[model samples]
Target: MAGAAATGGSARSDTYASARNWLLLPSWAVLCIFVLAPVAMMLVYSFLTKEFRGGVIWEFTLAAYDQFFFDRGLFGDEPARIDWTYILIFWRSIWQAGLATFLALLIGFPTAYFIATRPAQTRTVWVFLITIPYWVNLLIRTVSMKFLLRDQGPLNDFLLATGLIDDPVRIINTNAAVQIGLFYSYLPFMVLPIYASVERYNFALSEAAADLYASKWTTLRRIVIPSVRPGIIAGCILVFVPSLGAFLAPDLLGGAKNFMIGSLIEEQFKGNAGNWPFGAAASMILLTLVLVILMFLARQQARADREATS
Candidate 1:
């Protein structure tokens, strides 16, 4: 009788396993079809050659990547020289994204902390106000920035009327404008994650630090920051990754002068320059960068979890 019961239990377990696998099959199919398939196609396109006309050549070549790193001179006869233009644009994207992330963190942490410390009933109000800008489309928000920053726009007109400056400052089509736009656009992303972290934090630890005669800065640096490090990392990643591929703000605010990786890719895909293979290559590189960053963050989080448990 015991052997018969054990056999029945094993059969039931197998049935459950089969059911679970069947339930998961649809999701797996969607991922393979929608996500993996496109990525695989892009990877294949990146290795191919760009035709003189639109579309890619079937022949596989590394010319797309080669074009990114080297220029064979104007006539294609001289020795290969390193192209600093692409390198400069690449670094510009990195530093600008980093700067925007830093600025967002600077503002987001304080805002999130304030909201987190507020009465639970009123906390929702604060969050609602923070998210009001997101109600509008991103493209509209970016375009609205142009209207505000234009030479004859309200900002310049108000400054002129108030005697702040005799002349309208060149705010549009400049690096400063692009940075400001990026900070404004991605601030909410930073705030929301940090708020999530801060909301769950134990204020008792902060009070304990105060009782121990710790300075405010010391308490924040050592106690609050350590507790919310995951949120800060998440916010930074959320802001930085998107900022790297930002096209609208740079194009609308910075114009031709502030062409970024996103703009470069867009140009290759649809603009006057139609080099799809090179665009695919650039996209692959960006994907690799994002994946590496995510991997590093995952490792750090795992290590922190282990330490905390220990």
Candidate 2:
């Protein structure tokens, strides 16, 4: 009788496991269709020769990467020199994205703390209010920002009336504007992750730190930060990666003059430049750069985990 009961239980377990495996089919389908398929397309496109105008030829060549690394001059005949143009654009994108991440972290950490420290019932309302403005489309939000920061717009106009400066700040088509847009666009990504971390944090540990005579700053640096480091890292990654490829913010705010990697790639496919191979190459390069950074971070995290465990 006991053997019979065990056999029935094992059969039920196997049936449940089979059903669970079947349920994963849709998820795997979506991943292949949306993520893996597009990445594979980009990789293949990068090697193919660019057609006369916009498309790719079956012929494979390294000319796209060569163009990126070595400048063949305007007519494509001169001796190769290091192309600073694209290098500078890549550097600019990295710097701006890093700054945007920093700005989000700077503001996000405090905002998250404020919300997280609130009573459980009150926290929901705070989160809701914060997200209310973002309910509108991103395009509308960006355009609204442009209107507010334009030379004759409310921000500058208010400054002028109050005698804040001699001239309206040249912010409309500047890096500063790009930073602002990036921050506003992804602040919630930064905030929510940190809030999730902070919300789950053990406040008793904080109180214990206080009783042990640790200063607030010391407690934050030693206790709070280490505990929430994962969330902070997650938030920074979320903000930085998207800002790196942000076209709308740079295009609209920087007036297409301050070209980030995204704009540079966009121009190849959509703008006057019809070099599809070069665009694909640039994208693959960007993708590679992101992967390298993520790997480095993962290594660092692994090292930290080992140290903590040791």
Candidate 3:
């Protein structure tokens, strides 16, 4: 009787395990098919050669990556010279993204603090207002900004009419316009995370600090900032990553004059420069970079967690 009971229990456990595996099969299938398959294809393509006219040649070669790192002189026969154009673009993208992240933090922290400090009922209202911009399509918002910033647009006209300047200022199709577009588009991303952190914060600690004769600035720097560091890190990552690969803002606001990595990738795929393999190489490089950053952040967070527990 004891042996029979154990056998029955083991059979039931096996059945349950099988059922769970079956339930999870579809999600695993979708991930493999949709996500892993494309990435695998891109990785394969990155090693191949680019065709003269378009697309890729299946012959595996590192020429695509070589092109990025080395210039084969003017005639493609001399010793390879280092190409700095793509490197410059990469650095510029990093700089612009970093600047945008910093600006977003500067603006988002105060906005989030204000919302978090509001009465409970009104806090929801403020958060809703912050999210309202997302209801509109991003492309539409960026295009609208272009209309407003154009030399003869309402903004310039208003300024000119008010004698702010002698003539219409060139706001559109400039780096400043691109930065403005990026800031406007990603500000909510920055604010929402910080708001989530601030909302959960202990106001009593701040009060206690004040009671202990801590100045507002001292309290903010020593207490509030440290408490919300996670949210700040999250917001910075969210803003910087997307801004690094931003396409529409640079294309529409900055134009051809201010080409970025996103634009370069687009050009490889769709524009006159149809070198799919090269594009894939660039994409893989970007993906690797992002993955490295995420891993570093994950390690740091894990260390922080261990330290806190200890």
Would you list the C-alpha lDDT of every candidate in the order shown? 0.91, 0.90, 0.89
Writing each residue's lDDT as its tens digit, candidate 1 over 67-106 gives: 8889998787889999888878888998889899999999
| Best-matching candidate per TM-score | 1
Better of 1 and 3 by TM-score: 1
Per-residue error for 288 in candidate 3, Å, reads: 1.1
For residue 175, model 1's alpha carbon misses the true position, in angstroms, by 1.0
Candidate 2 Cα misplacement greater than 4 A, ranges: 1-21, 300-310
For model 1, the stretches where C-alpha displacement exceeds 4 angstroms are 306-310
By lDDT, is 1 or 3 better? 1
- lDDT for position 303 in model 2: 64
Pairs of colliding residues, candidate 2: none
Q: What ordering of candidates by lDDT runs from best to worst?
A: 1, 2, 3
Per-residue lDDT, model 2, residue 103, is 97
RMSD after Cα superposition, model 3: 2.2
All predictions: root-mean-square deviation over Cα?
A: 1.7, 2.8, 2.2
Error of 1 at 96 (Å): 0.8
lDDT by residue (tens digit), candidate 3, 53-169:
778888999988998888998778989989998878877887888888899999999999999999999999999999999999999999999998999999999999999899889
